[model samples]
Target: MRLSRSLAFAALFLLSLTTASVAGPGRITLPAEVTATGQVIRLGDIAVLEGPATAALGDLTLGPAPAAGESRTLEGARVLDALRRAGADLAAITYTIPPVIRVRRASQEVSEAAVRQILEGFLAEALGAGAADAELKSVELPGPIRIPAGPYTARVVPPADRPLLGRVRLGLEFTVEDRPVKSVWVTADIGVYGPVVVATRAVARGDTLAAADLTTERRDLSQTGRSVLTDTVDAAGRIARAPLVPYTPVRRDQLVLPADIHRGDVVLLVAERGRLRITAPGEAREDGTRGQQVHVLNRLSRKDLVGHVVDGSTVAVDF
Candidate 1:
């Protein structure tokens, strides 16, 4: 009986030992308080120092390598490895984390509109790692940061050995605003009767009259000669405007003529008055009032001249 019992116990112990050794290949053994020691992996003769991690991995281990023509997710593996390297304390690590992204196309202050990139990473937790370093950066959280709303930059550094290499973040920024110009108005004189002027050219709101504006006539001639009289019409567009300046000393830049006048610049004899005789005999076709002198043809002279016809046959000259 004693011999049989001894054999049974030995068998059970052997069975327990065997069971402890294996669990579908993955459960790696790591002492409860073991400092991470990095691994030097070999690819043929080349060796790469991988990581120093205290991983408490479960039922998952390296499987067979992919066949020569197989395609795989490089981004996925890269992200996984990055996370694995980040959290060296393994037993505590459970869920997978979002990838750390480096954004290059972003806009920031100082560097105005241009091709920019903002590096970013999604952390399962903020980890609150403040800023990133030159070679690496920390991904910033989503939401508005800084001016000119846009991509926030950051970098990711997988923890090597020393004190969990800190994370870093930066924001892209810029400035902009709307600007405008000024508009002006044209100066003009508007009234009920239209632009007002006199024999004295109307005073433009802010203007000084000079010598040319005055008119004076001396050595009056009874004989009529062709001459021009300019005048300005009203808003009615009628040319019936009367002469503003008579014979006088029309000064230079003075208020002598109408504000506007440039028309039938010819003289004609029409009528006469008292002892003072004007242009000679002429047909009183239009607006030929008595005192209005105009041009008339002298039958003897056969030429047009200014004269006042006292009656049907009698005529006088204002020469």
Candidate 2:
């Protein structure tokens, strides 16, 4: 008997729940202006529905919102169309009508981390091929970067513009899908760096380079062109063509090979043809490095002959 009574009570409880679900909520009241909490704005979310309206549209489906920071008005013909779609008998009901119903998108709060991520990616792209290994020095923004938060994306405004060089103001456009929402301007301190050879101390022109005079260091790649050597071996023993400052990048154009033959020095002039080799004492007319062509005066013949400097002692002359 107790079991039968409990079963009967359970059946009654289920019936009430079904009846309430079928009836839905009481008449919903819609304000003159409704702020949308999500992507879609529905009648159930924005309006107050009474028995008839509630029965007509248990849930009214409106289209998507206009934009993230914008609003859309639905009334008159639009409202009538929605009612028809909801299977409501518009002609039979004489309900109070308002001038218009406005649906607004709620302002979304943007986090600082989100904006920083965008700026970082933007600066990385500016590095081009070096982006993967490029190290950022510092990034600065003129003002707070904030935008209406939702499904959105960020990109360089012009797209075809040059990369951010040194410190400059940059423009980035934020979009929702394909629609543009806002543009943000910020200052960027971008730098791309790599290893380069730098002088350790001030050295005068014509001074020969030594290993202790140079050290490898990281510098902006933009300033370090192909003329800059990364290794001290290439720079060592080379004569300085210009005054090198301490801690400054050493460029290839700033150094030259030491001269092997000095001008006005006496050197042996050699002439050879297969096994026919002859030598004569001569004076160098101009300073020359090994393998360089220079004028040699034959001391006995008193004639200037062009020959290649072989070393500190010899200059090879033909004929």
Each prediction's TM-score versus the true structure = 0.14, 0.53
Off by over 4 Å in 2: 1-28, 37-40, 50-64, 90-97, 109-112, 118-187, 191-194, 218-229, 256-319
**Model 2, poorest ten-residue lDDT window?**
157-166
**lDDT winner:** 2
Candidate 2 similarity to native, TM-score: 0.53
Could you report the Cα RMSD, in angstroms, for every candidate shown?
28.1, 11.4
Total backbone collisions for each predicted model: 58, 7
Which number leads on TM-score?
2
Give the Cα error of residue 51 in candidate 1, in Å. 20
Candidate 1 TM-score to native: 0.14
Candidate 1 lDDT (Cα, 0 to 1): 0.30
lDDT of 2: 0.75
- Residue 156 in model 2: lDDT: 59
| Tens-digit lDDT track of model 1 for 148-212 | 22332333332244222233222332222221111111111111111122334433322433444
